[model samples]
Structure formats: C-alpha cells, structure tokens
Target: MVLERFDAIVFDWDGTLLDSTAAIAGAIRGAAADLGLPDPGPERAAQV
Candidate 1:
C-alpha cells in the first residue's frame, strides 16, 4: 500500500472568519421582535 501526504488542510467554523456576526444577530433579534417576542440581545443571538 502507498500513502499520500497533503501540504495543508484547512478548517472553518460558521461565521468564524466573516463579518456577518452583527447582521445575523440583528436579524434574529428583529425576527423575534416582529413576532412580539422578547429580544434575545446581541450576546444571546450570537450564541444561537
């Protein structure tokens, strides 16, 4: 059997390397508010 080697491997997490954190959190909060639910706040929204 033969084995191969890779020079590099990459891994990413959702929203880890992007600038959409605030936008996403805002959307969540907005949707909740529109439905007359309480705002999740930025920290909770981000965690969701």
Candidate 2:
C-alpha cells in the first residue's frame, strides 16, 4: 500500500493534540502523594 501526502495539514489543539489537563493533574497529585509532597491541584499544575 502507498501513502498519500497532503499539502495542508490542519491540527486541533484542545481535543486532538493531547490536552490531558485533568489526567496530568491527577498523575502529578498521585506522584506527589507517593513522594510525600503537597497535592498540586489542576489549576496549579496547569500553571506549572
């Protein structure tokens, strides 16, 4: 099979390009808890 190349490629940021804000925040919180650190909430994580 041959692949076709397109001249223009449109991408979506918020939904398509892995906008996992909540997942990242949860993972950070879990990791912090595991390492005995404060639970940085979603807002804080996003800021960082």
Query: Which has the greatest TM-score?
Result: 1
Clashes of each: 0, 0
Q: How high is the lDDT of residue 11 in model 2? A: 79
lDDT of 1: 0.87
| Cα TM-score per model | 0.60, 0.54
Q: Locate the minimum summed-lDDT window of 10 residues in model 2.
A: 39-48
Candidate 1, pairs of clashing residues: none
Judged by lDDT, which candidate is best?
1
Candidate 2 shows a clash count of: 0
TM-score of 2: 0.54
Q: In candidate 1, how many Å is residue 35 off?
A: 0.3
Q: Write the per-residue lDDT of candidate 1 for residues 1-48, one digit (tens) a residue.
A: 899999998867555776678888999999999999999899999876
Candidate 2 lDDT, 1-48, residue by residue in tens: 999999998878665888777877788888999999987877897664
Off by over 4 Å in 1: 1-17
TM-score of candidate 1 to 2 decimals: 0.60
